[model samples]
Target: MSSIASQSRSGPRRGRPRDPKTRRRILAAASALLNEGGIGAVTMEAIAERAGVGKPTVYRQWPNAPAVAMAAFLESTRPLAPAARGGRVLEALRIHLRKVAETFATRAGRNTALMIAAAQNDSELAKVFRNHFIMKSREIGRTLLDRAIASRQLRSDLDIEAALDLLYAPLYFRLLIGHGPLDAHFTDAIIDAALGGLKRRRRT
Candidate 1:
């Protein structure tokens, strides 16, 4: 049996061709609703009303509000911390992480925290959030790690899984726990610390 966290996207329904403009409006509306009132406010009716479309229009694209909310989060955040390619891998990753810190320090971060709390009780929401948002974001980070390792900037024997955790776990910890500030300074500290352990050691 498929786990709740492994649900896949629904197939397209037979209807009018999906319009790019309408899709954008729906996603934007959902994002706004999530930011303003958390995931509780992102119902199909609310999204349709906000997007100036019918309920069926929203339903046709997403099976439920959680799906729409996750989609909106991904759409809105994709550009904020895009994966860096080429150039010095560490420097590129540092710059990328700074962007991530800035993103986490905003209202979106609050919405994410809300989503996480909500997902604890909503299995469907948890699935989509983990598979789509969290895993996808980690995939980008993994690519950068692969590049760094290939370039020998990082220790060849590094454990990618543990290394990824070390690199990003603190940011999420701060974001979720709210104990410390999530900013460029914090990002630099994480990079410095993670790199200190990840970098290849000089042999005497």
Candidate 2:
């Protein structure tokens, strides 16, 4: 399971043991609302009614609609298959990028773009989204890069931060801008180009 799943359930909770079914219902309801009406459509009452639960029940699980929306988003983005252990790091990264591109073309991805746009004006949402979701995902990317560097598969002088940006930023830019196809071909092209710049130089 991805850390996103754990993060959604993180921090202290003050409620009875959470029922998985109830949680799924709530997330599903929240996702539906987001798809139907964007970020503004999801409300505690709306989620509860859609989930067949009371407002208090929703509150018991999440503080507000944004939190719930973020949770729903996180759930959708999870299972972003990690690089296979002991495989060539770049190969794993290639696979990972493909998954990212595929997901970015999904309804969840559309909702993510909307939430990010909405976050521009909502500081609290922006903070939580960055701290919990974006940062966590970056950490995952960072770990993979660290592995590549350690194995000497990438240049020792490689700037991990910039490398990550190179690997993923294009997909996101396309995702947000609606410019091009977010498909395997694009995934391969982007990763190949980025890796071409980052790979270790073979000595003659």
Relative to the true structure, how large is the alpha-carbon lDDT of every model? 0.75, 0.77
Worst ten-residue run, lDDT, model 2? Answer: 3-12
Best by lDDT: 2
Candidate 1 Cα misplacement greater than 4 A, ranges? 1-11, 14-16, 79-87
| Candidate 2 residue lDDT tens string, 1-204 | 223334357621666777788888999999999888877788898999999999887777776787788788877776354755775877877878887778778876777777777668666556665665556666777877888899988899998888888877887789888888899999899888887889888879
Candidate 2 — what's its lDDT? 0.77
lDDT of 2 at 153: 88
Q: Highest TM-score: give the candidate number.
A: 1
Tell me the TM-score of model 1: 0.82
Cα lDDT for residue 137, candidate 2: 65
- Backbone clashes (count) for model 1: 0
